[model samples]
Target: MRRPRPKRGERRIDAATDHLAQYGFAKPQIRNVIHDLLQLYGRDGWVFLEEGSYPMVLNRLLEEQAQQDQDEDGSTITDE
Candidate 1:
């Protein structure tokens, strides 16, 4: 009887799979969200950034929102 053989250049990533299986949680609903996030990871504006300060990002976003609100409010007053 002939035995099944692995494909060429097919490297085994046992550690990676093990790590994901070990630490990664995938509850019923969580699985879907994880899949969606993975799909968005490589898309435009959804870059895979490993290092960034969450607080800094939050502050920047808040500042941008404040600036946008100010611009809109100021523009309306000048036209009034």
Candidate 2:
């Protein structure tokens, strides 16, 4: 049997999957982030980000979150 076509919203998600996976986001986390983004921006405004800005913005946010997590837990996270 052939696979069904992915929805429009999923196109944006599929585009981001590899990038997010490289940053250690599992499927659930990626979905949660997408959901949060949708909630933050509202449906009409929730277009996929520009390619040039996406990675930079996402990296900064992830770094900020990592710092906050480390600060709260008082643990040192070494980068590989």
Candidate 3:
């Protein structure tokens, strides 16, 4: 079944944060990063999944986290 649409503003932000929680990155920081990302695209508008920008950004964030882990000698990764 199709999922219900997210409400604009707070609900959408919360949903985005919740989605990000599935990752090892810091949730609050990632939320801020997501906000900045959305703002960046707001002027140009977003693209569909067939476009590479969305996945590229996500992969870049994961790569950044990996870099941070290496910088910390691999001790900062989240367990859950």
Question: Pick by lDDT: which candidate is best?
Answer: 2
Structural similarity to truth (TM-score) of each candidate: 0.29, 0.51, 0.50
**lDDT of candidate 1 over 10-64, digit per residue (tens):** 4122222232334332233233433454466544322332124223223334455
Let me know the TM-score candidate 3 reaches against the reference structure.
Answer: 0.50
Error of 1 at 52 (Å): 9.6
Q: Model 1, which residues run further than 4 Å from truth?
A: 1-53, 75-80
Write the residue-wise lDDT of candidate 2 on 1-80 in tens digits: 99888886567666665566676667566656666666766775334543564553376458767887989999886899
Better of 1 and 2 by lDDT: 2
Winner of 2 and 3 under lDDT: 2
Question: Candidates ranked by TM-score, best first?
Answer: 2, 3, 1
Where does candidate 2 have its weakest 10-residue lDDT segment?
44-53
Worst 10 residues of 1 by lDDT: 11-20
Q: Please report, in order, the local distance difference test score of every candidate based on alpha carbons.
A: 0.39, 0.64, 0.60
| Residue pairs of candidate 1 with colliding backbone atoms | none
- Native-vs-model 1 lDDT? 0.39
Tell me the lDDT of candidate 2.
0.64
